[model samples]
Target: MPRGRGNRRQQDPIGGREQLPQWVRKEAQQPQRVVRNLRRRPPADADEEAPLEKRRRVDERQLVAMHPDVDFQKLLGGCDRLYKSKDLREPITIDILIRLNAALRHVCSSRYETIMFQTALNLAFAAFLRVSEFALSSNVIHEHVLHRRDVYIDHVKNQLFVTIKFSKTDQKGRSTTLVVDKNESNEICPLHSLKAFLQIRPGNDGPVLNKGL
Candidate 1:
């Protein structure tokens, strides 16, 4: 499903009409498909999937909406639980940051893209960020993902803060700030990497994570 991630409003305040992305509209307009090969009857239905317990049931519909992945699986769940619970995944830990940064830089098309990946990875880990906080999302609007203007760095404190202007959790549009301080080792340092990245900053046309690729 396409989600809004930038600051642009997708709906008129008074009209209440949805101004969804064209691609999302097109996708919704497309006919739904079913598998003729399936002989077994579906086990779950829509009503059963609602939030009856503390958490929504993980059924076929829920699984399909999950937008499957392996490393991410067991790590994340349905979007309805997005901000309700905290993420306690261990794989996106700092212990493997250096290795991940190295691998990203190894295959980047340019010095710009490499710096972006390194900076993004370090800041994300250090600040405990969600991808939707700074990356370009499906609709690229309404979700309020951070752009370059949202980042503030303190050279004296050796820290960088990301200002999230709005979010699903903060429907009132109240701003929240997340900080990433300097690491002892420059190899996996969010502060150091962020400074270096700003020195050779990439395109500022969109989301901070956008490489213009």
Candidate 2:
């Protein structure tokens, strides 16, 4: 079975007509596949797998060290503010989206296509509100899989989708989760909105969307 990422529906405020995109519909009708293929946890005394996790931890530590003044509290605070605001739209402009698409297009490989980049971007944005996260390090966001068997053996089959957790802060500095669902937790909710606004059609429009080969 493909990893189920769930579904999303858009409703017009004026006409109240609910709409679901074609890609979303297709994804619903078929099993969804993702690029990530790694075990969520290490096996018992697996010396070879230990090195990979160790390297990842070391890299994460180094990344944190490189930015000693990350101010995670501040970052979290900003995201909280955005989440609470009445504006349901995201702040990213079309220019930024276009630039990202262009860059991905330039580096297309024989194996990977634009949709992979698009979904990766979507997942990254879902995790972090800013595109800068992806721009800063595409490697971190890109989920690479060597083969189908690797995906299962690695225990990472179809785990590429992201989930958002909605929460609120109280005066006591404690946080309370309001909702935890895929549809509500979409970080690219704004970008998705913009895509809808532009009426982007699904076809061979360069980097916009590479639906099928």
Candidate 3:
């Protein structure tokens, strides 16, 4: 004979209570015990100074003790002078850039190479670009390196938009577009030089500056 649904025994709501020891079960049946609140230990004394502050105080005392007659401001100024750079790098001027362009024209073996070098120099000077921004460190092309596709020419606006995908300042790969306007001089005009270079540049995708092979 099959058992009916109503004939089955009902389970205890607290099923695991039977498995517990009698003492534990008895304790559980009683009201919950009062629990004392726990608290973190009090912070260090408010009057106590930080390690750096203490060190600074100690340093000041030593300085005063050793050099009682020396002026504190003058001593600090003298210390600062010790770390200052002595080498002064001369800034690049327009005359230097023009001379460089002229030198490249004579030095480059082919017109293609000359245009490429000239355009790069002009673009870098006008945009204030770092060498790593546009040029590849190795022979292999990186995603961050400027590509031919990254350059856009606006004939109507007479401006060229160059996208810098990565730079020292922009480590997060947040790209920035630099707008270079047409220069008055044909020799140093980035837009004019870029246009001439693009005309001869290969249609294949790669770094903007490449061997015209």
Candidate 4:
């Protein structure tokens, strides 16, 4: 019987069925390659876990075998100590604030700047205000920022009322009023400093410490 093209068997140059074409071998190996890759890949949960979380799990497992009296949190306090030891911030005292005001008098370019700095320093110290409470983030003014309208001076009572609309502690926007009284010293008194700044301050509605004013 004569063999047709479709009935003929195709063989490699080596004349062996085992030695097939490169594409045919590749196609046959693809399933095995995929299986090997799947075996090497980590589980989804393991991949998502952080190094700290992994360390915590290991510690927890070790803790299960340890004594009940062992305080893990107390042991972790060492890390906090190491972090705090590197911190550079120091507590600001009254003496430091006074010295800073004196330095500003010489360093400030103009009387406007001097008064502004002095007022801000004293007010922040007296009111225990964060930088965000009394100062704008940038040149742009926001509705939540302390404005001229927020300040009310009671000359009769000799007190200054400053309304803080937004604060870290008060996220709900429930406003809080700070009452600043006159001090014996004219230099560091928040009320006196504020009054001095207001005298030269422009009669415009904006942030209390704005340079544009």
TM match of model 1 to true structure: 0.54
As for TM-score, the candidate ahead, 1 or 2, is 1
Each candidate's clash count = 4, 2, 0, 0
Summing lDDT over every window of 10 consecutive residues in candidate 4, give the lowest-scoring window.
32-41
- Candidate 2 scores a C-alpha RMSD against the true structure in Å of 35.6
Q: What TM-score goes with each of the models?
A: 0.54, 0.21, 0.58, 0.59
Candidate 4: where is the Cα deviation over 4 Å?
Answer: 1-86, 139-141
| Candidate 2 collision pairs | 39-154, 90-190
Query: Candidate 2, residue 182: CA error in Å?
Result: 12
* Clash-forming residue pairs, model 4: none
Which pairs clash (backbone N, Cα, C closer than 3 Å) in model 1? 4-143, 5-144, 5-145, 6-144
lDDT of 3 by residue, 1-213 (tens): 464433445445677333544455588999863435446322335325555455676777798888899889888899889888787877678999999999996899999999999999999999998889888778524888889989999999999999998888998888999999999998999999999998899875988987775
Task: Give the lDDT of residue 109 in candidate 2.
Answer: 72
lDDT of 1 by residue, 86-189 (tens): 76777776668878888986798888888888888888788777777767767646348878788888989888888888776875778898877778998788
Q: In candidate 3, how many Å is residue 190 off?
A: 0.5
Which candidate tops lDDT? 3
Best by the TM-score measure: 4
Error of 2 at 178 (Å): 11
Off by over 4 Å in 1: 1-90, 140-143, 202-206
Model 4 quality (TM-score): 0.59
